[model samples]
Target: MGIWRIGADVLVCSRFTVSPLAQTMAALTALHKGRADPGRQAWLREHLPAYRDRLAGDRVEELLVWAALRPRWLADFMITPPRDDDRTFHDELRRVSETPAEVAAADLATAIGAPLPPELRVPDLPGRAAALLEWIWTHTVLPEWPRLRRVFEADIVSRTGRLSTGGWAAALDGMRPGLRWLGDGRLQINTYDNPPRDIPANARLSFIPVTTAHGWVTWDLPDRYAVIYPCTGLLADAPTSPAPPVAVSALIGPARADILTRLSEPRSTTQLVALTGQSLGSVGGHLKILLAAHLIHRRRSGRSVLYYRSPLGDRLLKPE
Candidate 1:
């Protein structure tokens, strides 16, 4: 597994940030794969057709996209270390557009682990890469960036709360499939067979949440680093699918019943707030009522208390 030896100083200095560019790049990666996780399937379907249409005859663009996103690798220029002040997408895109042409070629070759394909051996690689990203961002990602930003904010909110209450152990676990906080100072970022790295002592660590199903880590050594992780699209379908029975909704009120419906798996108040987009007070109140009626059970887990649907609650949610 890929382990990072992060110092307590680095941990303390870590912060959460959002990047429209990273989100757009991740969506491009999903498009290259021609698949998406269930949470992002609708987004893929919506944009992929137009994407294919645009790339259909553009040989250089097609090969560049494939090579930049080789499995287990990404061209370094594609992953800029985000800054607190670089607030606009164009601010970050400029980093790609201005990369020295040689550096961009080297990065693509490193990602592909091969000599440049003849088509990719062209001038102004950075400009072309930037242009492709701009097209994807303008056409596909920017339209829904507001919605995407909310998901990023909510994930950050849920995580920072965990960090304060439960420490890094709570915040890092499950951010990605293979990431975990090993005891002491070791943080496993992935399960790849790679050498363990020590983050720069003065580095500002940032965790970036994206809406796409995939993610990666990048850094401009000794200064800025980012861990992009998947925080699925907002849970908009929570109240729609596996709907509460009419009788259940009627008995409990639609809002409370929707909360009950989500509790088949245990979740904490913080988790529910992030997933449901409800205020802490409001979610707590619904939990109180459900507990009073014995429709849910609460269990203490470390620094957090978790809630789950009770047997009676399950019976009520059962399909008619």
Candidate 2:
């Protein structure tokens, strides 16, 4: 596993921050890959065609992004961790644009884990890559920033509240599938077979959340380390919308109806706790009621059991 040996000082100083650049990076990565969560399918359909058109003529830039953003890796040129007080998206992107050509090329090679193509070795790599990122921000991400920010804020608040009630391990675990807190100042960043890394004393650590499922590590080393992770707990688990109709609420009771309504997308109990701000026992009891009534069905997803609305539940919501 990629263990991060965090010092007490660093852990105490660690923060949960929202970054426009990080969020934009996540969105751009999703655009490049043509993916979106079920709720954001509309967003993807709206932007993906334009994104493909933008990349059609720019082979070098297309290759650069494909190489720069690999699983668990992002090129160093774009790895700047946002300061506690970060600037606007354009200001942050300027750093990516201004990276030395040689440095950016080297970073891309490292992320790609191989040598670069001849076309990618030129002086224009940084500018073109940055321009593509800017286009993603302007065309796809910016229009949705206001709504995304609300989700980000809610996740941050939920995280900080967890830190207060349950301490570090509870707050940090399950952020990513393999991430966990091992106690005694050890944090497992991922399940890679890499050797453990000792974080420099007093270094800043940031946990960034975004709407996209794409996650990658970033650092300025000796001072900063960051993990950009998806907001799955809030985004997939406890949706705030999908409020049940008045008739459905009247039939099942508002709380159970709301719970049934959210089951249109599968969710687990832990996620329900995070989303609904309900106690685990309360959520479990609610699930039991739904299950016994045959209003939902269950399936396993990794370590969690996800519940989804059954046909009966669907009919209940849309009675003829």
Best by TM-score: 1
lDDT of 1 by residue, 198-283 (tens): 88788888899886555788887667888889873342333344777898889889889988988988877755765566666678
Please name the candidate that would achieve the greatest lDDT relative to the true structure: 1
Per-candidate TM-score against the hidden true structure: 0.79, 0.75
lDDT accuracy of residue 270 in candidate 2: 52
Least accurate 10 contiguous residues by lDDT in model 2: 232-241
10 residues in a row with least lDDT, candidate 1 = 232-241
- Model 1: per-residue Cα lDDT at residue 103: 90
lDDT of each: 0.82, 0.79
Q: Give per-residue CA lDDT, model 2, range 1-320, as digits (tens).
A: 88999989998899998888888888777787788765567777898898888778888878888898887688878758887656688877888899889989899998888999887988888898889888888988898676566566656766776788789976875677778899999988888999999999979999998876546668886788998888755455233666788988887787787778877878866566555655556677889999999999999875346999999998998888
- Pairs that collide in candidate 1 are none
